[model samples]
Structure formats: C-alpha cells, structure tokens
Target: MTRESGRYKGKRVIQGGRAQVRTVLYMAMMSAMQCNPVFKATFRHLVKAGKPKKVAIIACVRKMVVILNSMLRDGVMWDANTAKN
Candidate 1:
C-alpha cells in the first residue's frame, strides 16, 4: 500500500489507508491520549516541534501500532521503558 502525505492551504493532510483501520487507530489514539504516557509524550513532542495537533496524534497512533506489532512478534508484554527507546 502507498502512503500519501501533503498539505492543503498550509495544513497537513495524510491519506491512503483502509478506512476501517484508520477508524480503529483513531479510537486507539484517543485511549492512548488518556492512558499511554509514551504516546502522550510523543504527541506533545511532535506538536512542540511545530507539527500540527492532528499530525502529532497520527504519529502517536503509528508508534502505537509499531509497538503493538513488535510485542506480538516477540511474544512479550508491554514495557514502558523499552517502548520509550
């Protein structure tokens, strides 16, 4: 699958993905915002670095997916310290 990133009127726009997956990611992101310190820090860092709020949230969602995938692949439990790295 191809990922597309662009700007419209100075606003970042990210597109290209399954709608269902996108929905799930967004829901997970919302939960992460409340309960995941790593994700919360990632979002804040991105926004502080000049990224848009939505962009930062998307970044966190991507990070969450990667972390989850690695956890499953390695048959390991979540570790906050390891995830930070």
Candidate 2:
C-alpha cells in the first residue's frame, strides 16, 4: 500500500487496493475494532508505537485479510488464542 496526502491537510490516505475490497475490509475492521481481541490488541500496539490511528487500522485490516486467506488455504477455523500468537 502507498500513503499519500489526503485532501485534508495532515491526513494521510492509504491507496492501492480495489475500492470495493478496501471498502469491505474497512467495514470488517470497524466490527473487529469493537469485538475482536486480537485485532484490538494489534491496533493498540501499533498506536502505542506511534503509528497514526488510520495507519494502525489499515494494518489491522491487512492482518485480517491475511488471516482469512490463510484459514481458507488451510481449512482451519478461527482460533483467538492461535491468532494472538
């Protein structure tokens, strides 16, 4: 992904994926932020490391996608403890 200055000054935009996919991932992230412990921890870790909130959110989105993909490839179900590790 690439970061660019957004129309609003001081805001950064993440660009690079298909808009529809990005939109869907953003939606999933909203839910993940509310209820997924692993995702919440990941977001908190990034922000605590000084990353911008949006940047941290995008990182979580990417992580979710990767986890989903791997689960599909391996025919495994979601496991919070495994995911946390």
Candidate 3:
C-alpha cells in the first residue's frame, strides 16, 4: 500500500511501512500535543472535561488525521487557528 503525502509540502508525512507508519503517526501526535499550541489547548480542554488522558490523546490524534485529510483534499495551507473554525 502506498500512502500519498499530497502536495509538495503538507502536514502528512508517510512512514514507509504500514505498521511503522502507524507508530510514527502516534508518536507525532504525541509530540504535537506538546509542541503545537492548538493541539496543546485541545488536549488540555479534553483533560478538563475529565476525559482519560489516553483517550483524549487518541482523539486528538484522530483529529489530526482528519485535518490532514481535509488539507490534502482541498489543497489548503496549514493554519492552526483555521482548524477550530
């Protein structure tokens, strides 16, 4: 299976193997929660709701995938604030 990274430069980075890609994606998501302001806020919001940290993190990761998908489909640039809109 081939994973497309979309345009010349986009958020999606396809790791070589399927399993490896999943692992890498999960790690990337974790890093985003720490380094990306939007993701960090979202994660904190989820935590404040009494959600399990693991569950909230997974949800954030899923959101990231969806956002990446939308960007790839629409050929839009990454805008952290635009994601919440």
Candidate 4:
C-alpha cells in the first residue's frame, strides 16, 4: 500500500518499491533474449542492421506488451520460442 500511495504510483521509477515494474520489464526482456529464440533472433537482427542496442531493447519491450495482450485476450499460454508477429 505504501508503495502505491506515493505520487508516482502505477508509474515507472528508478528507485523505491514502485521501481519493480520497470525492473520486471527489463528482466522480462533480458529473459526473452536469453531463452526465446524468436526474440533473440529479432533482437540480433535489429542490432546487426545498425539499430542501436537500446532501441532494440525498447522494441523488445513493446513486443512483449503486445504479445502479453494477445495471449491474455486469446486465453493462451505463451510459447516464446515459436511466437512471432
């Protein structure tokens, strides 16, 4: 409750308990890069094509949100290895 009571509740932060959201997003992206073949390949391709690493990370984050939304709406479990838009 305390964490969510602050002015930045439900927002991204670099500090405080509320920072978990950003941390989790970052971790999810990193995890996908490590274990999700499709994401890994996409990220590598992006980087190789001269897209900055940071830009690629942001792309992965956006993709994660879209994938999550699709899976939730469709009532499906995610298969990161084979999942590609």
Give the per-residue lDDT of model 1 (tens digit) for 1-85: 4444464255435566688999989988988888988888888889899997887887888888899999999999999999998
1-85, model 3: which lDDT tens digit per residue?
3456446453333446578667787899889988899889989999999998887887898899999999999999999778874
User: Clash pairs of candidate 3?
Assistant: none
lDDT agreement with native, every candidate: 0.84, 0.87, 0.83, 0.78
Best first by lDDT, ranked: 2, 1, 3, 4
- How big is the positional error of residue 69 in model 3, measured in Å on the Cα after superposition? 0.3
lDDT of 2 at 4: 53
Error (Å) of candidate 2 at residue 68 is 0.5
In candidate 2, where is summed lDDT lowest over 10 consecutive residues? 4-13
TM-score of each: 0.80, 0.80, 0.72, 0.69
RMSD to true structure for each model, in Å? 3.4, 4.1, 11.4, 7.3
Query: Candidates 3 and 4: which is better by TM-score?
Result: 3
Error of 4 at 85 (Å): 1.9
- List the candidate 1 regions with Cα displacement exceeding 4 Å: 1-12
Query: So what's the TM-score on candidate 4?
Result: 0.69
lDDT of 4 by residue, 1-85 (tens): 3334557646432345556786798789999899888889889989999998877886888788888898899999978554775
Residue 46 local lDDT, model 1: 92
CA deviation > 4 Å runs, candidate 2: 1-13
